[model samples]
Target: MSEYRSLEDKLNYQFNDEQLLGLALTHRSFSNVNNERLEFLGDSILNYVISLAIFQRFDSASEGELSRMRSSLVRKETLAEIGRELDIGELIKFGIGERKSGGINRSSILADAVESIFGGILVDGGFLNASSVITRVFNKRLEKLSSDDFMKDPKSLLQEKLQDMGEPPPDYIIISTKGKSPHEVFEVACISRVLKKEARAEGASKRKAEQKAARIALTEMDRDR
Candidate 1:
């Protein structure tokens, strides 16, 4: 009971099927019957929920603006941030191999678990129940939405900045990755072929790592300018 209480308080959603909640917190690295299906279902539901909410909330916004806003909210980093607030990482059940390799702290696992929990809610209750949970979870973010919330993703922004300087596109190289599948950390190097600049960063996914490295490169370029 104590084990579940903290998460319940954080999410503000009590589980009718505690088993489903358990499944949600179980990573694929732990078991064959794992959170993957739930993650898939939850991903779709989250997109729909966020899209509809943003669409109705921003009546004057164009399609492009809406899409950008949605991307910002649903990105892996954002989801992992929210999952951290819930302390979901500590609760994730990983296999011995995954545990020894530091899979529990992996942002990708935490983010996917968050989505799986949403899917569990949908299964235990219904769409409206899950929608209520999503609304509650996202209330503050939705309230603070604005034109300022939208921006090109880090990778895109970095690429554009280099191109504007008459430089060749940055070359991204994966330095290494750690932990198990679906829960690995990607270390990437962002190298500017023309400027001979290099920056390295790590993230839960390859794309995220690349973006982080690119962001670092961009910051250095800006500071130099």
Candidate 2:
């Protein structure tokens, strides 16, 4: 519990029931009384909160556009990135086997833990508190989001940008693979000869790795302009 003080500080929200927080961090691999139920509840709350936020924020957006924006915000990759930002990986309790297999950094586990924490907050404080926390955590992301950005995926956007500039489309190549079947991690590189830029990222699947790499390359290109 003492060790979680840093995490609490990062969240800017303290738990009245430390046990709820503990349960939120416990993976099924660690205990039968794990965070799955909380994750389920949190998933619902997250969707609702983000939906309402975007609805009010993007008053001009169509329903389909709002849905796409919400999906982008609540996706597993985004949640896992949030978990990493909050340092939730260190707090997750996994079974010996899972720990040995590097479960802490696994995106699925990190994303689940984040949702469970939201669920824990809801149980401890109530909907208002959970909404507050969710909004606070997602505020920056929401602020930076644009209707045009959510309309296209990173790959599509990158390709379109290159095409508009008369440059060739970027190429995605799998650079490396680790682990075994069903749990393999792939490293992919997004390369663009015209821009002389390359970005690499790792993910649970080749597609995800390619998307991440493309996102990174896009960011770098944006920075250069």
**Tens digits of per-residue lDDT for model 2, 1-225:** 377898888788899998899999999999999999999999989999999999999998765557667877888889999999999998899999999999999999999999999999999999999999999999999999899866567788789878977999998888899999899999998999755557999999998998888777766664454
User: What CA RMSD would candidate 1 show?
Assistant: 14.6
Tell me how far the alpha carbon of residue 103 in candidate 1 is from the true structure, in angstroms, after superposition. 1.2
lDDT of 1 at 61: 73
How much does each candidate deviate from the true structure in C-alpha RMSD?
Answer: 14.6, 14.7
Instruction: Give Cα distance to truth, residue 27, candidate 1, Å.
Output: 0.5
Per-model TM against the reference? 0.68, 0.68
Which ranges in model 2 have alpha carbons more than 4 Å from their true place?
Answer: 151-225
Instruction: Name the regions of candidate 1 deviating beyond 4 angstroms.
Output: 148-225
Model 1 scores a TM of: 0.68
**Which ten residues in a row are the worst by lDDT in model 2?**
216-225
Q: Which lDDT values do the candidates have, in the order given?
A: 0.82, 0.88
Candidate 1 collision pairs: none
